[model samples]
Target: MKIVDKIGFDEILLQLAEEASELSQAALKLRRARMGINPTPITCEKANLHLLEEIADVTLCFGILNLSDTEFDYIEHTAKKKYRRWKKRLGIDKE
Candidate 1:
C-alpha cells in the first residue's frame, strides 16, 4: 500500500504546516539565545541543535508530502527572487 493510502493527504498537509511552524519557532528561539533576549537561559549549542532537529522534521514532512523535483525547482526560483528583493531592500544590491 502507498504511504498516502495509509495516511490521508489532509493529515499530511496538516503535519507539514505544524512542522513548518515548529521550525519557525525554533529559529526564533535560536535568535533569542544569540541575542540574550529571553529570560530563560539556553545554551547556543542547544538552540542550534533544536533548530537542526526542527529542520529535519520539516524535511521529513516534505518527503511525506511527496515533493517533486519540479516543485523544488519552482521553490528555488521563488526563493532567488525573494532573496534579490531582500538584498535590494537592505541596500546590498542595486537590482
Candidate 2:
C-alpha cells in the first residue's frame, strides 16, 4: 500500500499545514536576521540555510499529497498570473 494510504489524507494535510507554518516562520526569521532586528543575531548564511531546510520540508509535504495533473496545472497557471501581477506592482513588468 502507498504511504499516503497508510497515513490517510487528513493526516497528510495536517502535516502539510504544519510544514507550511514552519516555512513561514523560517522566512520571518531570515528577514529578521537580514535586517539585524533579532535580539539573538544569527548569521545570514545560517538563516538562509534554515529557510532552505523549511522550504524542503514544505516541498516534501506537497509531494506526498499527490496532486492530480489538473490541480498542478491550475496552481502553475495561478502562480504565473500572480507573478505577472507582482512584477507589474513593482514596476518591473517587461511586457
Candidate 3:
C-alpha cells in the first residue's frame, strides 16, 4: 500500500503520540510534586508506564507506516512478547 493510502492511519498515530506526550508531561508534574522527604513511588511508576506506552505508540506508528501484513504480524508478535517480558522484569502486572 502507498503512503498516501495510509494518511488516515498516520493522522491517528500522530494523535496518539500527541496524547502520550501530554500524559508524560502530566506524569512529570506529578513526579516533581512529591520530591524530597515524601516521594510518591506510585506516581513515579505511573510516569514510567506513560513513557512505556508512548514508546509503544511510536513503535506501532512506525510499524503501520512501513510494514506489510506478514511483516507487521511478526513485528506485533515480537512487540507483545517483549512487552510481556518487560512487564515481568519490572514486576508490573495489570490490576
Per TM-score, the best of the predicted structures is 2
As for candidate 2, its clashing pairs are none
Off by over 4 Å in 2: none
Model 1 spans > 4 angstroms off: none
lDDT of 2 at 79: 100
- lDDT for each residue of candidate 2 in 1-95, tens digit (9 for 90 to 100): 87699999899999989989999988988888888855447777898999999999989888888999999999999999999999999999876
- Specify the poorest-scoring 10-residue window by lDDT in model 2: 35-44
On lDDT, the stronger of 2 and 3 is: 2
Could you give candidate 1's per-residue lDDT for residues 1-95 as a string of tens digits?
76667988899899889989999998999898898866447888999999999999988887787878999999999999999999999999997
Model 3, stretches more than 4 Å misplaced?
Answer: 1-13, 16-20, 23-42, 67-95
Prediction 3 TM-score vs. true? 0.38
| Angstrom error at residue 52, model 1 | 0.6
The digit string of per-residue lDDT tens for model 3 on 1-95 reads 65437577668667667866776776665666457355555666676776677677665657556658898789789999999988988889552
Clash count of each predicted structure: 0, 0, 0
